[model samples]
Target: MSSNDLEICKRFAAERAVLDREFKGNVVVGIGSGSTVVYVTKCIAETITRMNKEAEKDGRKPDLNVTCIPSSFQAKELILRNNLNLGSLESFPLVDWTIDGADEIDSQNNIIKGGGGCHTQEKILASCSKELYIVGDYTKYSPKLGTNWKKGIPIEVIPVSYVAVKRKIECRLGGEVLLRMAVMKAGPVITDNSNFIVDWRFPEGIDNWKDIETTLKMIPGVVEVGLFIKMAIKIYIGNEKDVKIYDFSPSNE
Candidate 1:
């Protein structure tokens, strides 16, 4: 296969190999929404089939029943397409693992997600997991999240609250905020749930990011911010040569 084809398949295969080793029998998995994580779902499907085939050859029933929880409508569709079992948040309270991608990851391991407009559900699914693993390419790693993911912080809000929420982010917070327009193919870029997205920007050299995140969340119209703080347990980075894993344990640096 060519490099372009290799890039698409190789990265997903590497991530799948890691996940297959981590997930054994009867695992509860969270499927995150994004282009990179789409490969993750595909990997899970192949792994499940391999396990089932192995059991058939041994004349034994496979106990590797995988239940997948989706972070978005796109994720839900992928789950069904892969022939994997599906469950809702209300049905499965806890997940064994969550595999996701990030917009950016810093030294602290805090991330910026929501590039697919599924920030709210992604956050919920990630928190429900026992261990959350982020799978992505080297381009996503950054000194800070907003530094590389210059798309700005994606904030999901109630439809009626868009105007008020925009003012709070731009005026009250003294930062730049803009209403995300529908550029993909339409009048407005409506989300799966028909909610609007507002991207917020802070000064280039922001000192207190945590404080800013806290302040923006306090706004009434805001539903959820894209700043994912202390959610990932480990990150599996896909470099050109190989895949490297990083733990989110406490560290001075």
Candidate 2:
């Protein structure tokens, strides 16, 4: 986020994907959580404004009544900052699309998310949407799930039951679960919903992601797990040289 060139390139990938892709009948969009989404929301606002101006010139009303539903508080801030029409999932339950970021992804399109501790909401948005697009730099995609990113899975839990959830994960899921501590604030990091986070990392890393995610979610206090299986319909991978987009059908663009 500082003056890093890589971060800037990622911004291009995020913005370019939304700018280039056609959202023909998409009126309601689910905005996701991450640095990349910051650019995506801005582009949406810009495009909407441009469309409105063009419509006015043609003596017709602006028709792209795009409404953005944010996944988290940070995402909500981005939506408001861009001067876009803000909406909620309750109103727009079935979204046209959802764009999000991933910490790590594999050949099967499985992903490890929630480095931002917003995976709970991120997953919900993706699950609720008709299509989910994963956006990031080329570095995010890996041959194996844990080989590139081994930072562990992020799990949001109820604060009062964090201790029990941590123990359950370590005992049943075979990983070391640590209560996520706040780097900028005192004590544990609290989510927008006022829940606690527990990041679990297996010393050897994960292979059966779906099973692991299911096990973690079975715990009484666990709210959500960071492992995402077969949720993304497409991925936009960007490099300094060029950007590549991959779909679940093994096609590229």
Candidate 3:
């Protein structure tokens, strides 16, 4: 297979494994954004169909009730296209599990998301979830943050405060701040929250992720930071042949 095809196969493998393990019973699930997560929604829909069919065969009521909460507009469309029940944080309040794709995942499982400009809602769903699980191909794995994902840390900021936030992140935080521009539109990319994204090209070899995350969030007008420190309970990394599971352990600290 070609490289892109191989990568897609890996993504499907990892996403399928995660859905098979975590998507069960009557539960609300948070669906994350990104290309890899496309397979996640597909796998979940397939699972639901299979389970309901089994129920029919056994002459039992279809009890595989699963409601999907989307983390972005793209994710919402995916859920609806797949014929899955759509829900919201205001409605579900608490999610049983969240499955997302990360731009990069370090050995500590500290992840950099928001490559799709949906980190704000992604973080919200993650915070509301009882557990967060990430699925990605081998290319996304890294020994540390910034080792693989080079675009920079994605920060969602208020539209009016984007300039100020960019300046602060550059001056105080010491990084190349860039306003993420739109591909088709004329100006900067607008997030689903109507905010703008600033990609902070931070230097590598950083020691503290949690401190930086907190400091970034403390900045006024900053909606959310893409740095997810110690939030994920597990990550399913798909290699060429199979999926590798990374379970977070406090001892790794």
Candidate 4:
């Protein structure tokens, strides 16, 4: 297959594997944002259909009871378009598991998310879920966070304080900070939560991501940083050949 086609197949493979393993009956699921996550929602919808059909064949009520909680506006639309039952964090409060896509996944399982400007809500759902799983293609896996994903760490900040927040991140954190501009709009890209996004291109080969995550969150007007430190239980990285699963360990934490 062509490279693009192969990458898409890899994403499908990883997403299908995640759904087969984690998507069981009567569970609340968190659907995250990004291109790869598109496959996840599709897989879930297919699974639900197959499961309900099986129930009908067995003369049982087709109640899969899988409620999907979206992490962004895009994710919400994906769930609704797929004809899945939609839910809210306020209503569910606790999610059984969450599957998301990552911009980059390091060897330690540290993730760089928010490339879609939905990291704030994504992180909220991840934190609420009992388990957080990531799925991505081979291009997203790396030995370090900045090795592959060159778009920099996405930070959601208040629109009014974006200038000040950008300055602080550049000055204190030592990175080339840039306000993410909108492609179709006139000004900066607005997040689903109506916040602005700042991309912090930090120096490569940094060893202290935990400290950096803490420092970035402490900044005023910062809604959420894309740096996910030790929050993932596992990552399913799909390549042209097969899917590789990385389990989180205490040493990596």
**Highest lDDT: which candidate?**
3
Poorest stretch of ten by lDDT in candidate 2:
244-253
Task: Identify the runs in model 1 with alpha carbons over 4 angstroms from their true place.
Answer: 1-21, 184-186, 249-253
Any runs in candidate 3 off by more than 4 Å, and if so which? 22-24, 249-253
Task: Give the alpha carbon lDDT tens digit for every residue of 215-248 in model 3.
Answer: 8999999989999888988888887777888878
Clashes of each: 1, 0, 0, 0
How close is every model to the real structure, measured as TM-score? 0.89, 0.91, 0.94, 0.93
TM-score of 4: 0.93
| lDDT of model 4, residue 112 | 95
Over the stretch 1-253, how does candidate 1's per-residue lDDT look in tens digits? 4557536544753465346455566778888877777788888888888878999999999878789999999989999998889988899989988888877888777788877788888988888988788877767788776767888888888788888998877787666877788776765456666788888876677656677779878998777788888777777777666776777845622
* Residue 103 error, candidate 2, Å: 1.6
Candidate 3 residue 207 Cα shift, in angstroms, is: 1.9
What lDDT tens digits, residue by residue, belong to model 4 across residues 39-97?
88888888889888999999999877899999999999999999999999999989998
RMSD of each: 2.8, 2.4, 1.9, 2.0
lDDT of 2 by residue, 25-119 (tens): 44888898888788788888888888888889999866677889999999999999999889998888898888888898888888989899899
lDDT of each: 0.78, 0.83, 0.87, 0.86
What's model 3's overall lDDT?
A: 0.87
**Candidate 1 weakest ten by summed lDDT:** 12-21
